[model samples]
Target: MHVPDGFINAPVSAVAGVVAAGAVAVSLRGARKELGGASRSAASGGERTAPLAGLVAAFIFAVQMLNFPVGAGTSGHLLGGALAAILVGPYTGVLCISVVLLMQGILFADGGLTALGVNITVMGVVTTVVAYVLFRGLTGILPRTRRSATVSAFIAALVSVPAAACAFTLIYAVGGTTDIPIGKVLTAMVGVHVLIGIGEAVITALTVGAVIAVRPDLVHGARSLAVPLKLRIDGELVDAPVAAPAPVAARSTRTVWSVGLVTAFVLAGFVSFYASASPDGLEKVAADKGIDAKAEEHAAADSPLADYGVRDVTDTRLSGGLAGVIGVGATVAVGSGVFWVVRRRRQDEPADARVTETV
Candidate 1:
């Protein structure tokens, strides 16, 4: 849920900001190892995390626009934390979501700029930490088949959405701007988001399964937990040793990247038009319970791409489509740039660190 301005008091908002900033700082350093292939862990065998992480960010931004209805006139979008953390590492996943939230706030004016820290903390950190931890736990306990990993993704995503709802409820209990009863808010938020979590779970499961089917090596959550690939010899099945990671430059993810980028553009540009128009879980809870009584207008309300439409375009389809396309392009560009830098930092680290990770 994207917490808008005025929902939280300035002091709490500032505190959340500092907390979110610290999280981002920590994630930045952690992501270097993930993105740099220091771990040599890709489900697709030799794929690198940097490119996939960028696509994951862009894909999350695109899929988020396609809000599926969760009944009771409430709609929900993909938070992408579970999906990202499963596809990439938790640290890099945090960065991916932060990038999406940042773009949405500054460009499309979806999330409030002032409440950005709240959004990042609840949506990014809380969701990622909760989902990844659960996914790891479940995968560890279950059979080490690819199906088990996919099942873990489903369960992890299912729990993460409501966990985030609970987190927001706690935050609201502390700093809510309205006079609504905290108990009612908590019940309503969790109830609606539980339904929303189903939607999130389905999406997360399908996406994780698809990636694992083709590029299991590319999936971070599936890494090491995966069963060895079996090749049938003349008369029997034989386990094949894992292939060494290809040199970074020699590994080409162009096919996957191209397909993912195209899918993102198509979803954001055209498919988004069919998304349910009803308010999402948080918006519905806030409106029905009077929590948004003091909400402020988005500061970027006047931007050219505000509200996912072009400023001067008269045709609704064309305007929204163009805005969506621009958003995808911008998100991919910025995400790739950020990951590139993170990966570079890993390469620049003292040679011993690489040896340590490799060992």
Candidate 2:
């Protein structure tokens, strides 16, 4: 849920801001190893990881625009934390959601500026951390097959949504500006969010399954879990020997990247047009429960892309499509830059160590 300003008092919001900043800083450092392929294979390298991470961020932003209905006059969108974490890693997943939230807040004016920290804490950090933990736990107990991994992804995503909703409830209980009963708010938030979680689970499972099927090596969570290919040796199955590393420049992920970018474009530019117009779970609950009574205006309300429609573009479809495309482009560009830098820093570490040794 995108928390707006005034929902949390200034003091609590500031505290949340500090927490968010610290979380982001830690994630930045943690993402270097994840994106650099250090944990998977030293020979595999991470040149493709940077751009893939960027695409993941852009894809998440695009899918988030397609809000599907979850019954009872309420709609819910992909929170993307679970999906990103499953596809990438937990650290990179946090960065992905953070980038999406940042883009939405600044460009689309969807989330309030002052409440950025609250949204990141509840939506990004909580969902990613909870989903990753659950996914790992389930995978550890279940069969170590692709099917099992996909099932784990589904369960992880399903639990993560309500977990985040509960986190919001706890935060609001402590710092809510409204006088609504905390118990009622908690029940309503969790109830509607449970339904929303189903949608999230389906989306996450399908996406993770698809990625695992095509390129299991690219999926961070499934990389080490996938069973190696078997060879029939004298009518007996034997594990295939490890293949030699591909040339550094030969391991291009251009095909997957192109396909993913096109899918994101289609989803945001075309599919989003038919998305349910009803308020999302959080918005519906807020309006019905009066939690939004003291909601403050978004600081970026006057931005050219406010409300997901391009400024001065009267045609609804064209305006919204343009805005969505712009958002995807911006997110991909910014995310790619950040991840590329991280990857480079990781690559430089060994050389720096060598230089220090020589000195």
Candidate 3:
């Protein structure tokens, strides 16, 4: 959900700005560990997965362009908040979605710049925390099957939307510009988001399930609970016994980069045309509750790429499609670059005794 400028009051927005800044700071540090550690961990038979993380972010960005009809006049897209956090890690996932929000706000004018902090907080932080908590809790008590990962993905995303809605309501209650009834805002916001949450759940579960099927080792949320990979010996499957450890395989990173960039281009260029053209969760709530009365027009409204249309491209479909493609390409490039740096930094660490001695 992209919160416009007028929904939350000044003081609350300022506070949220600080909170969002802090969250981003923490995420930057945490992302270094997650991306780098995962890269190092992949030194074994485990597959290289950092580029998959970037691809996951790019995929989330593309899918979010399509908003499915929820109810009444409102529509919602895949939140991807929970899905990203689960697939990658929480910190990296937050960075992924924050990048998407930044692009949408500045380039497409989909969200407000003044309200960027709020959008990041409610959507990124709230969803990640809530989903991660629930996922961990459920995975702890339930079986460690891929089904658990899928089920957790569904439920975690389901709850995250409304939790964000409630958080916005609370913020509005504290800093609402209008005198709208708190009860009305709360009811409307929560109700609409509940529907939006369904869309989020389906999308998150499907994406998570798909990734788990292909590369369960890459999913950060499901990492701890994964059953150890085994080899079939004498027609019976058993965990591969640890012996004198073999040298870590050095796979080419080129394939990961190529595949990620290609997929991002395809989704944004070709697939986004079919996305539903309805207002998202935040836009719908603002209209329904009079929260948008004082909304400020976006400063970048006249940008060449405003509204997801390419500059000087007269064809509506082509312009929008090209813009989407460009946006995806930019996001993937930037995201992969950041993650690659993090991964490389990890690789640069003082060689550990285990690796140094072996080498």
Clash count, one per candidate: 7, 0, 0
* Collision pairs in model 1: 42-217, 42-218, 43-216, 43-217, 43-218, 44-217, 44-218
Model 1's alpha-carbon lDDT is 0.90
Q: Per-residue alpha-carbon lDDT of model 2 for 1-359, expressed as tens digits?
A: 78888888888888888989999999998787687734333533355566799999999999999999999999999999999888888998999999999999999998778889999999999999999999999999998899999999999999999999999999899899999999999999999999999999999999999988887777888866756789999999999997865554433478889899999888888888888899999899999999999999889999999999999999999998988899999999999898988877766677556345336
Q: Candidates' TM-scores?
A: 0.92, 0.92, 0.87
Q: RMSD, model 3, all Cα superposed?
A: 4.3
What is the C-alpha lDDT profile of model 1 across 1-359, one tens digit per residue?
89999999898899999999999999998887787644443423323678888899999999999999999899999999999999989999999999999999999999889899999999999999999999999999999989999999999999999999999999898988888899999999999999999999999999999988977767888877757799999989999988875554433467778888999999999999888989999999999999999999999999999989999999998898999999999999999999988887776778787778667
Stretches of candidate 1 above 4 Å error? 37-47, 228-252, 353-359
lDDT of each: 0.90, 0.88, 0.79
lDDT order of candidates, best first? 1, 2, 3
Off by over 4 Å in 2: 37-45, 228-252, 350-359
Residue-level lDDT tens digits of model 3 in 1-359: 78877767777888999999999888877776677653356442223556766676678888888879987888988777898888888888888888788878887887788889998998889998888888888888889899988998899999999999998898888887788899998999899999999999998998788767765665788777656679999999999775654443345345544665676677778778887788887787788778888888887889999988988999988998899888887777777777787667666666683355336
What C-alpha lDDT does candidate 3 achieve relative to the native structure?
0.79
- Superior by lDDT: candidate 2 or candidate 3: 2
